[model samples]
Target: GNLPIKKVLIANNGMAATKSILSMRQWAYMELGDENAIKFVAMATAEDLKANAEFVRLADTFVEVPAGKNLNNYANVDVITRVAQEQGVDAVWPGWGHASENPKLPNTLKEMGIKFIGPPGPVMSVLGDKIAANILAQTAGVSSIPWSGSYGGPDDGPLQAELNDEGTIPDDIFEKATCRSVEEAVEAAKNIGYDNGIMIKASEGGGGKGIRFVDNEEDLKNAYIQVQNEVIGSPIFLMQLCKNARHIEVQIVGDEHGNAVALNGRDCSTQRRFQKIFEEGPPVIVPPETFQKMERAAQRLTQSIGYVGAGTVEYLFNADTGNYFFLELNPRLQVEHPVTEGVTGTNLPSTQLQVAMGIPLYNIPTIRKLYGKEDIYGTDPIDFLVDEYVPIDCHVIAARITAENPDEG
Candidate 1:
């Protein structure tokens, strides 16, 4: 990225974004050594902070992160700001969509004159809420699913999407996106207009945590009750179930100068119970034409909104007609960034920081012309090139790559 840096702070602790923090720290050190370049700090529970003694040691400082029992987030912006003020950090990178409306974080950090190393809070809020995301997708004309507000609660209001009541879900939906009122839910079921089956999602949540398929009215009714009970504390959600669908997503970036381009699209169909255990880029299906069309739609959304930074737009592929619908938008770096990195040869975090700091992308001529299918995926390609094997969503993977650190070496 060639981004000149002096200081950085990370606002979450998840193994998923472990590489982003460590790599940035190491890469910065290598580029600028320990003096004028930078240092890193991670905020999370004191217990979690203690667990990674070695990793914490690499950080210039460590701040005790406070969270509720669920660990739903590690966002105590007050504490983070104090540390940033004390340490004089130039930026705070919310790792992997970590601060999803922790409310106090963004405004506090902005007030302190420290940069939030992600997109604007408005963009994040627009994409974080599932229903809002669905609306954004429709407005952008992107392919994904339509989702109504949270469903399933005794005293709750009405629901607008479909519902099911046949009773047997392959798994269950109460776990993540909760539910709405039964009457509202029942009415929603009648409105669905599909014969095969319908989906019940937790409207107030995600992380692929709460979602289920109710094959019939009986299932939908039972699911409504179950989800309503489950989300008594947080709201449960519901949506238009896209069955036998191929889940796909594209990592998009826009700049202050009005440029929105896709890094690449990933096929997340190999998920079991909605948790994506495997993924690969340059979609297995969706010929070049379809891919480009999707990208154009996605870029239009980001461009229209003047979106900047690393964001992901998710879509659903309908097997019935091979059409994609807007599922939602992830207005932050995703877990699958490595797939895009392997293809684009670009540092997304650097791009995001630059853009957020009022830097334009036009100077980088390769912004949109990055990585064609010929450069990576294709038959009869480069004879001297090594073949690559990316995991398709299917099995248990507990693997690690071990290598000597170049700096140490």
Candidate 2:
């Protein structure tokens, strides 16, 4: 175990990597006067160099790689290791995309004796598997959607199917099953009650990659096989598609020592076709107690898995009934983590580095400030513990989307 990380590599590209670089710069400025205290190296692709010229200049050093090479690729592993060894980088941080959730990269890095600034590979594997994530959530006492389905692993079985469309089932969210074949799935969809419609999801897909929606039995029959064809390497299952559910998630930080905390929550309800369009923290509408319950559940889930780093536990909230179900657990830095940072005044990126260096959860200064000492709760400014019952005194929102030029097409 390293005591404190010195040189670190920003092993990913895009805005997430840029944000991490900026966050690290800010943290270095405020905490450590020495600009070289924690050196940062970036893996720059041709596109990154073109798009993020500013970051290229800001990095302590960078190794140029080919364009379109994903961070999770094995080839990148050798590249990263060579650069790390050459530059004396003690750890690697995969911001939020590409290799962030890919367990293989972390496992490989660990074998090379380099710290991966996120959760362990086994933890990622469990959370990466949709069905395993569901079972973990339930074991952690979190309420998850009523689901049924099994992962057939490498060997495709009766339950196995493919997925299509733009939506993905976060490899960890299991599916419900009443039948096996397309005819059986259609019949089962009818028996399951499609008042809210039926949802077809891949057992091991995410990012809206393997999902299909059908409003009636006829639609279900027609789309069943086609939906399964969309996904590869996993089984698809059915579920009661929630028509009007608010997507809320709790931001969690955990350390190697088994302690964890829920910073706050975000409402990413403003989404289009399963992609989040906007997100805001301390959602304006949710009551206080309900929010507390979510925080508790999120902490419980992360701690249960010995999660180390910044991760998010998503939920489906029904405003009418005030009920929520655990949706999925994203075991890496989320794109919307800044929303939680804005509300909680937490330096998540820096904290993530500290955790990777073996810092315990409670010992983190921000955690102690937010969750005060046991003896002193409110009056102590230094040890001020954030009251779970009271929401943070700030609100933050984010909006970023991609669009095409119609005229060009």
Candidate 3:
């Protein structure tokens, strides 16, 4: 049931685009042979062309997007989709940033009969929203941090109804732990019993934005206000901050046929200002049993949501207590995915494209060995346990280098 996908549009720029294009070519050469190599279309702004960006140069062909601001080009769903349509692209690859997680992009591509190399629009919407994702994770039996909000209880009937109807949670559905006022936040903090501190988090927050740490009631109001101001109108929630916890994530891939597998994981605890600086696979700090539990939880969540494509299920592991809480599910290829690839020997970008082409995980040659089954088909029961089949052969770590202003430092 594979759909034809001869041409792909890399709807991003820079490293994300560069890596994806390279992987796609490598996958084509190895899997499809030289005569059937997939053609790639890379995008660039006027300024990028002037700089002679590496991705544009690597692509089989390049398209020009407007310069000035990203919204007019890279982040613009209209522009990206338009380019895809114009180029006769069979599939679109939104690497990590830009419009990767924006459900609008996928929804639009779905409508246009073009394949989106990630989760479906509805699945993306559910997982992209922190509040909805947390509730869904809880429903899927994934362990989550104690937090204030609708924990999929009887009181969340209205919210659940709305989600079922629209595939999204409305602003008015914020209940229990979600605080609109400072008073509600204080009560939530007290109820959660944060010995270390409580975090005021915006539901739409990511990459260290829209977050505030309050150690006591005295600072709670100000922190709450700051977070509210940062994300304006976004639902805010309170959660007990796990002190000295290691950041861990499970690399998961699901297919249209309901098959999902966990490809081990990485420890991304090395961070500065809430941004990961280093990442490594086969999280040795966490016990093997606990890590397996994470893998199972991750795979269960993926299958429950019917998510198709490459994704990362993140968690905060308290090594001392051997307890871990689900953080979030990033519904697209992650920037730090190379660490998992290094250990698992899987090319995530190529896998994503294959999944988009209606190929099941059991059929994907790069991942088929992990399942240890020769005749797994679309009609078979979905059970591919990573611990039973996949072995972590090596440990690999990645360090990120960033340029910063000396004055700011």
Candidate 4:
């Protein structure tokens, strides 16, 4: 029954790794009695340490790991476990992206008696797979985005490019059938009333990489093949496109005992090419009642799967219909989490560590309270010393995404 976490290893790299390091540092300085009580360790490649020397400076210990050739292969379970075991770290937190949602990593770490700071492996396995997560959302009374169909390729040949069967999809949800072959794609497009338009998406894709919008028959054929080309060895599906839709999401945190709480909502409609560029908390576009509905649905889905730690539930909201559908659930810390934390006045890193260490959600941090009855500025504008929860009354936004220009190529 050892609950004191003296050391934590951040088994991640890049910006997420940097942010986690800073958050832990701030947490230690503000909450923990001793700033150096929680020894920090960052597992990075040689190049990573050289480029991000600041991480090396912030962390108490820096361990070298293989960066591999790409992001997916950068972080490995063996490397993380070896470092944790050698350095005597009590927990390992996978910063966002890369192997953050890998079920095997958590499963292996837990088996080794190391605390993996995130949801359980079984829960992650369910959420990581889009098809399983959608079905789970439906069962939890949360309306999921309508899709043409769902397909799982043969187990023996995972990358077999043969057309597969259309799984059981709800009548209201299913719009078109999947087109594994070029011929089937053409036939299915005509059958689904292609006048409006159809969207081709990879079942396992994220960050708007494998989504293609096709408005005509010719584009459908081209997009079908193009999508297959973009992402091979993955099942693809088609869905009807909702024009002028708003992208919104709800942030939720849960504990081991199945208690989940939703931290308001965020509107991330300002996106380019399906990638969000700007996000704000307490969505201004969604009505209050609808926002409450989204929060409830998100909590229902989170608790339904017995999810723990910090996660995000995304949705597609249509201002016309006043209806929203579950998009996906990110079962790890998200990039836009800071906006939620800013408004809620909660230290996410501290809460996440507490939850990972089996501390109840209610006991981790005190709810924020108003400093005075007047609405004016002063040295200390607000107070978080209250024992009960207080309503959130401000807006926080997150923006800026620096990237190289593809057109330059």
TM-score of each: 0.74, 0.84, 0.92, 0.82
Overall lDDT per candidate, in order of appearance: 0.59, 0.72, 0.84, 0.72
RMSD of each: 10.5, 6.6, 3.0, 7.7
- Cα lDDT of model 1 overall? 0.59
Ranking of all predicted structures according to TM-score, beginning with the best and ending with the worst: 3, 2, 4, 1
Model 1, TM vs. native? 0.74
lDDT (tens digit, per residue) of candidate 4 on 1-409: 1367778998776667677778776777776656786888877677876676666677887887765553423456676778888988889888787778878888888888889889988888768766556666766777754454422223211111111132233333322334567777666556555555778777667777677889888888888788887878656676666567898999888887666777776888998766779999978889887887888888878777788999999998999999887778999988888898887777677778878878666545432222122322222322121222346689999996657596875
lDDT (tens digit, per residue) of candidate 3 on 1-409: 4798989999999999999988878888887687247889988899989999999998889989899888888899999999999999999999988899999999999999999999989989889878788777777788877778533235433123134656665545436447879998887777666587888899898878899888899899899989988888888888778888999999999989888889889999999888889999889999998999999999988988889999999999999999999889999999999998888778889888888888777777766555555653333443575336556779999999875577887
Q: Quick one: ranking by lDDT, best first? A: 3, 2, 4, 1
Error of 1 at 366 (Å): 6.3
Which segments of model 4 are wrong by more than 4 Å? 67-73, 149-195, 367-389, 406-409
lDDT of 1 at 103: 38
Minimal lDDT window, size 10, model 1 = 380-389
Q: Is candidate 1 or candidate 2 better by TM-score?
A: 2
Give a tens-digit lDDT track for model 1, residues 294-350.
777888888766576778877787656868776777777877776766655556665
**lDDT-best of 1 and 4:** 4
Give the total clashing residue pairs for model 4: 0
Q: Which prediction has more favorable lDDT, 2 or 4? A: 2
TM-score of 3: 0.92
TM-score, candidate number 2: 0.84
